[model samples]
Target chain A: MTTYSLPLSKRKRAVKTRPPRDALFIAAACALGLIVLVAVAAAVIPFAGDPARIVGPRLSPPSAAYPFGTDALGRSVLARLLEGTRTTLVLSTLAVVCTAVISVILGLVAGYAGGWAREVIMRLSDVLYSFPSIVLAILIAAVVGPGQAAVLSSIVLVTVPLMTRMVSAAAMSVAKRDFVTTAKISGVSAPVILFRHLLPNVSGTIAVQGTYALSVGILVEGGLSFLGYGVQPPRSSLGLLIQEGGSYMLQAPWLLFAPAAVLVVAILSINLIGDTMRDRLDPRETRSLV
Target chain B: MMSASHPDTDTAPVLELREVSVAFTSGAGAKRRTVRAMNAVTLEVAPGETLGLVGESGSGKTTTASVALGLKRPDSGEVLLLGEPFTRSRRANAGKLQAVLQHPHWSLNPRRKVGESVREPLTVARRDLSRSEQRQRVTEMLEQVGLNPAFAERYPHELSGGQRQRVSVARALVTEPRFIVFDEAVSALDVAVQMQILALIRELQAEHRFGALFISHDLGAVERVADRVAVLFRGDLVETASTEEFFRNPQHPYSQTLLEAL
Candidate 1:
């Protein structure tokens, strides 16, 4: 065969360009990375300051030795905050990971295997979605009897519905794309087409949705703990800290502020990271944003 | 090597569609309606011959292509590929048939690189080829279509429309299929790029001697690439003739009108 090119070489060279990266997006990603690293460190390393130790006077203000001040139990607020980050991050990550795994399977099945299977899966999802996630988590936690396992499972249950719905919708649209049909006509096997073509196309959407789910999972777990239905005494969850600190809000204030700040930071970082990913992954969103 | 070549002798046609019909039904009971998409469209692409199926937008050109590709099973008709009864399950002769669809941007998966897309058929159908052999074949096909081997690493979006079309051609021909359906493959391209793609397709078809069903609306494009041209108007094939005969002397009134319109 002859190698005859259309006089497109010059044009191709002319159009050699890169998509501009947003500074704000870069900053948010860096901040999120730093937050994740700190959380991982807190989870892995033993804290030098004893979170449960009564080392100082109660209701103390922030100081060099006890940064973030002391709680009602005269325990170091800094230590408790680190331990709480570990607890929150671990539970939220587990819940999000479980929700993602289950949702991906259900969503792909619902979207690709359209008809009675799709109808059943979607109806099940609808039943779960009808209830507010927090209320659903609380109800599940209440039923299972308060413990860490119960809290984790409840958050997973609460999140799976929304994640599945998003993934299914994304999969359906991706399934309709010409490449899917192209792959089909090439005599590619069904499983190969599904896992290779359909799954990869929808994965960006899944990642973005999963990040959003992580933020929600954290909030739900915190709410459950605050209500005395999650993470029983001595586990040192951020929500439990807030619960214990609520009564002495007027006096110390630092007790509530310490854990509250960490929780807010975690949620905010995840949301920001998720938004950045969505913008980058979906060209339509990026176009609209520009 | 297959008995499909040499149409001058009495051999089986590379592709044959006999009285194929497709109708879409809508609504129920009192509001029922049937839209006839294709009406007994009988056509054939001889071995090593290019048959251009030309028609307006709703003239059932795409429907004809779909039937040939086994994408949509016709309501009633006998379709044959390589002298075998064309079943919807095409796995028995997978890589022996292929297609180069329109919209190169959409035809190629966005998540995959060009090399993966080009070598997909071989990967799925030609399990005999080693990984290195497949890579070599991909690069060779890319070169044949006037693209660099480096293009293997680039995603579809990174390439120009013409370059992407080249990748599409490489993919279609990679399997060395005896029959290929090019559904308006160059229509989406600019005039210059269209000519280059047309030239490249004709060149490759000449080298491989594969029977081609080139579906397009462009009269000049069809005349340039097709050995025979079939005109469709409103779900029915109006006329078919050798390229010279059709151009010099159009018989049917619809064909005359279509030529005049062109």
Candidate 2:
């Protein structure tokens, strides 16, 4: 029994030196990496034939020559899917980055400068929060008209308030902490305290929220495009592809399956990655997996 | 009353708060009430002196320190740091003051390494010190506070409570400020650890000569370290005397009870 226990203890020690046993985290990370690689390739690389040109027979079934078959216009579904991936990623990423920057600034100002400024900023966010975000995005998109810019700004408008509220709450809690007061008492300038002390401490929350924003941005942009208010004609988006495929669902099932699969894959990967990052960044999450 | 231009201005108290009052409005509308946190509080700590401020919880000892530290502006009255008028709005004497607050766990930024925490004051107040000079001074200050130099590389959570408080001390002293407010600096530690910390504070004070306002509710602990003790009750200064005199023959009823309570 002693001999057997000795070897078992050694094995446990070996396990301790290995990376954490978080299967879900690993799977999500791989999925996210693959999706990002495809997005980057689609953005920079040209397909085998003109994505806009009719390069094959219409409604061709999935085969070696046409991996995802063909659509009604004889355009390769594979090429269009790639193009749509680029559109979805670039637009959503752009909107989320801008939203994150705006929200962080607004949050820091509202939190560090309490009193009338805080009251005004917080109330404004509350007003924005009262509106349904998707409905609000669509309303703004209609006013702005159809284009990538319209979709981007519409998403930013709806998402910025939510992100701002989150960041502001985090900033306010941190501001009340002793370290922040310590900084103020030491006579660290207001701007320095906001950036150096407040910002770094809240960065983990900001990052996790930013990741979640990417998923929201993609969903919002897709919803707008599906309703014919986003990406317009000539340009392609995942929602536009899915919409076009929806009409031919019975005749060409591959058209619906392919883009829908990518969309689901993209959104799921982003959410999972966000959750994993939140878990990893949290100081209290120390449960070792077997 | 001495003139502001007196020749001995340089020798004036390192920190002086005269009749400082602070009030806060709690609740809203019909239920609104103004809570007086401090009222007519007058105190001073001479250069190289340790003046202990003792009071019950909510008695406004911390409020007085806040005014002295320039963290909160007094509703009325004056604060002088190094004989210069001080307020939250004033920038002229900002970094000339420092503090080691209670709860060292919450005082230092957990995300920052201990070295950066120690060197923070220098980075903010003494930017003229070169990088190498700042690093050298941090190491020396850590040593003075009886902490290992290598402890600077560790995070605040990695250190024991006593070690973190010592790091707090090093951070407060790194700037070599004219005055510091130790707001219950030793109250949170174990009794044995508290003794070590008090000894280290005395040793450092002997070398640096920075006036300190030691605010604590622990009467026995205050007696060990304070040269002079001031008692506060319900936001008013009840008595101020040397530790020996106050303990020998207390004048105020509160002071007598405070001594007996110890």
Give the proportion of true interface contacts each model preserves, from 0 to 1. 0.49, 0.40
- The regions of model 2 sitting more than 4 angstroms off are A1-21, A43-49, A282-290, B1-10, B87-90
**Alpha carbon deviation, residue B43, candidate 1 (Å):** 2.0
Error of 1 at A172 (Å): 3.4
Across residues A108-128, which tens digit of lDDT does each residue of candidate 2 receive? Answer: 889888889888888888888
**Which 10 residues in a row give candidate 2 chain A its minimum summed lDDT?**
A281-290
Q: What CAPRI class is candidate 1?
A: acceptable
lDDT of 1 by residue, A45-73 (tens): 75547677898998899988787898887
lDDT score, candidate 2, position B202 = 87
TM-scores, all candidates, are 0.87, 0.89
